[model samples]
Target: MSPGPGADSAPAPKPHDDDHTSGTAPGDGPAGRGTFSSLGIRNYRLFFTGAIVSNTGTWMARITQDWLVLTLTGSAAAVGITTALQFLPMLLFGLYGGVIADRCPKRLLLLFSQGALGLCGLTLAVLTLSGEVRVWHVYLVAFLLGMVTVVDNPTRQSFVSEMVGPEQLRNAVSLNSANFQSARLVGPAVAGVLITAVGSGWAFLLNGLSFLAPIIGLLLMRPAELHRTEPVPRGKGQLKEGLKYVAGRPELIWPIVLVGFVGTFAFNFPIWLTAFADKVFHAGAGTYGLLNTLIAAGSLAGALLAARRGSSRLRMLLGAAALLGVLEIAAALAPSFWLFAALLVAIGMVGLTVNVTANSSVQMATDPAMRGRVMSLYMMVFVGGTPLGAPVVGWLTDHYGVRVGMATGGAVAVIAAVVIGLILLRAGGMRLKLDLRRGHRHVRMVPRERLTAVV
Candidate 1:
């Protein structure tokens, strides 16, 4: 998920679902309470803490779901197909989801979505525990879960600003990433142990039960603390107007493009890991979980860094993208299991840096009126890119070998850096070059007129 970007001095609402009230007040921020400490706010604190607990279960369920499918089917293709099904709805419904989010009461909408997710988790647990589960059952459940996510993602994103206001929006978003990534770390490891001990069914049950936290958080929040908006317009112009607004700004457009490219192409750690543990290393589920753990650990650290640096910078984001590519290649060449895990940690750190940074930049830069639509675009590419890349990546692993497949993605990422950097430069009305000879990469983001006149 992307954090809303920019607006450093004031925490302002992003384009919100008109129903949310971003309740900013006199001297609200200077009291050391809004942005950095919005978590300290009465309403947001409850919601944030609740989110942390809920997110852990969500990650746990995802890990178990993938593992369960793989264990029963023993087919990588099945995993890929199911993963594709889970995300395909995002690609198809993202725009519509944005529309729904922009028009609905985000809190109320989230209540329903979270409940659906819990029920989905419970149903999966029951079916799987019964030992009557089949491949199709997993697929159907995954598809339903994906459908719920289509409704859930934008609403949840748009809801944060309502609770914390725009002053603390960046921090709230960063903390949210931190929360999700922290959950990512706990969920997978716990799922691994549980799957190896009690069974995957229990993990699903835990996830189902976890939804209660967020549901309660929603019920407890004070609407007076939220940013208020006029009634939602059902105008046919909503989508078109939002797209036009997004297309018009360089601050916003560049970051969205950056995230779209990187998210679609580079941040595919899960599918790539399957190849690492199974094909290249010829290992099993334990090794797979360990690899994910290493990556999640790195990502958790990256989230922390982003949380501290609440401002957005395009140069920083691009630099992270470049570093992420370099690490991908390094991970591919890791000589042993332990070394590979170490490299994966580095890969995860840099990958999350790319992810969190790009996400923060795009979300912050977008217009408040169109945040839902813009975020949907961000997520649509981030998740949608998987369906396109996974099958191809899986095929490459199957045919060309895992090392080559991993290397291929890394190489593409590197090429993307050079290409995207130039694209951003040219689009920014500037020409730039990167120098790495001084034992560090130094890039100067000079203006177009200055660079052109120099030549």
Candidate 2:
């Protein structure tokens, strides 16, 4: 993978072609390599430090926003609407956002997007503080934020490779998730206290101020050290070309399809958790925050474990997703609050595993030239499906019990994992095998030819 046309500006080393090997110097042994190895790079360290602060504020805003919407309308369905508005742009213009990401400098795009996101938060903060806020005002700000995220999400994802290069990409991606989940552990707890004491306005104000850290970090980065890719020139048919490229690769395509299914139906936690906290348990905002914090604890553990691994596997993605579904079902049926809370931790761990595995696998399989567009489609299917799924989940929670709504989501995840797993196996010219003998491999996917020869 040599640098394409127009990449001459940056004189950094080219990214390695291999995905599994770390491309380290001979003297750099195991001691120099591990989960935190990518943080050794100065630029990534700055980015990581700034990102943790911004991510914490983002999480606080999320908790505060959901609670505010719930308090205003007193309907679970309204919270779904707010979530939907915030993600609607991704569903509609996600591909175009990818095209823009490929054409523009990712760092610049992130700066502009982050600033716009901060403005949205500040606007909401002002309205709420002045006692002029209405439900529609929140909806409008959410939609504006989504418009910015249409460009921000893919840009931020593709930027990781530029900072860490190929060998350390998987580790960096896993660490990024760990950073978010770590913030998640604190954000909701803080939001709960603020909402109870000062009010949601203060949370929004803090979130608006948080974007400055990332902006300053970006300015401090060294341009010559970045592994820059040539920006895709403006041209016709590029979007279609990106789509066809993904369509041809089973390794890239199948994992994405599986995530799309799971993300769409099973990942409606905003709706389910809020409903359970309010309706089922008769608890207040503190309980909702506690549920989120528990999930975050498990997610942080899952992300740390992922960072320690050397590679991502499709099998791991499938297994984790299946486990996520089973855990969700169990949590949905728990008879007591303590039991349900305990299950949430396990569910969070498996859910994060599924996310990290799929994300790294897809990025590893993609070409640098096509990464922006590929990641855009990846994010589109993953987060974009929220608009369609959230309202339905909210309605179900409103009409049927929260238990039924959550269990249904779990059922969808289980069915999707089984179906996609079988498809991937068959596509690879393999078949599932079962053996019952002691000390034997009981279940696995064997090559079709190997099974035929055994028969």
Candidate 3:
């Protein structure tokens, strides 16, 4: 049923090439390496280290950018617009960017993309430090950086298997999430202090400098050690081919749809959190940073837990999404700031569960030849909806108040989870039943093929 793109067009892979499986079990070569197995590979180690530096800088920039936008305009809608601009390019070119990743040398492409991103950061830094930064300046740089990310995001995702073969891909993906979460924990706290002590300019400048670590790491990677796949040859209708490829697979399409809904409506944390800090809590940047750090703390734990698991399953994904939605709703109704913050930790954990499971499932289910395209489609839908949703969510928060805004996202998420879950259940030819016998009650979804219905 995995009707992927034309695998016949792809050349036979080398012996050292990746095995196209969802990386659940440990690979024979690295069975002894344990949970940190991906780090044992020299190339993955280099990439991982570099990623840590860059991701930290990215988080710093994110906090600074949102705060700066608010400071300049005093409008949540303006902040939302900034977020929208950053992701708008991905909505436009993300699929095409995946095609480019498949056709080009990923390592080389990353070098250029990373360099461009750093330059954008630096330009923003200079403008801010000189007191010449305007709202347009922020908007322009966000869009430019996002344009570069259109290329960078999918390439980086597909590049993981190159650094660590498919056997370790699941572990690698989990570790990568952990790394990013780790950065989330540190970057926001640091950005807060720096913003208070100096200004947003220094945070931008440091992030610009952080790019050098990845650039240097890329240069240091051993080309021969990489488990490289041959680039897809240039051909007409490749993008169409990718769409058709995903369309044929239920496993691929379902998660993407589920994530698309969650990402669009529920993942507007920047808008939600900032409004809470400014409006509800009536706090400063430090409190906002604290809010971020708590979520990151929970997310970090969730990532570690995911790393411990050998496989990501569909049940995990659905359950996590449902839990996340419920928690989000609960958080929205919190009577106090501390209660809301505590709920954030649980929200972070459930959110990561959905993310890690969906990501691992898609990558594992996809064929090697079509990994880039599938992942690009994954990124496009999963992230692309942000541009369309952020502004709307921002407007809601601006007019209806933070609680209503949060509640709106929460309600949408819960509905999406229930709808997607029912669709998947029926697709599996099953129906849920509630049974009460001997004063005990239970509920379950039974397979239609196995059931005898009483008339």
Report the C-alpha lDDT of model 2 over 187-283, residue by residue, as the tens digit. Answer: 9999999999999999999999998988888878876677787888899999999999889877778778889889988999988989999999999
Q: Which 10-residue window of candidate 2 scores lowest in summed lDDT?
A: 19-28
Q: List model 3 lDDT by residue over 272-325, tens digit each.
A: 999999998999899989999999999989988887777666657877887888
Query: What's the residue-level lDDT of 48 in candidate 1?
Result: 79
Q: Where does model 1 exceed 4 Å of error?
A: 1-36, 433-443, 452-455
Against the true structure, whose TM-score is highest? 2
Candidate 2 stretches greater than 4 Å from native: 1-33, 452-455
Q: lDDT tens digits, residues 202-251, model 1?
A: 98899999999998988887766666433246888887776787777655
Pairing residues by index, what is the TM-score of model 1?
A: 0.88
Give the Å error, residue 36, model 1: 5.5
Task: Give candidate 3 misplaced runs (Cα > 4 Å).
Answer: 1-33, 438-441, 452-455
Q: Largest lDDT belongs to which candidate?
A: 2
lDDT of 2: 0.85
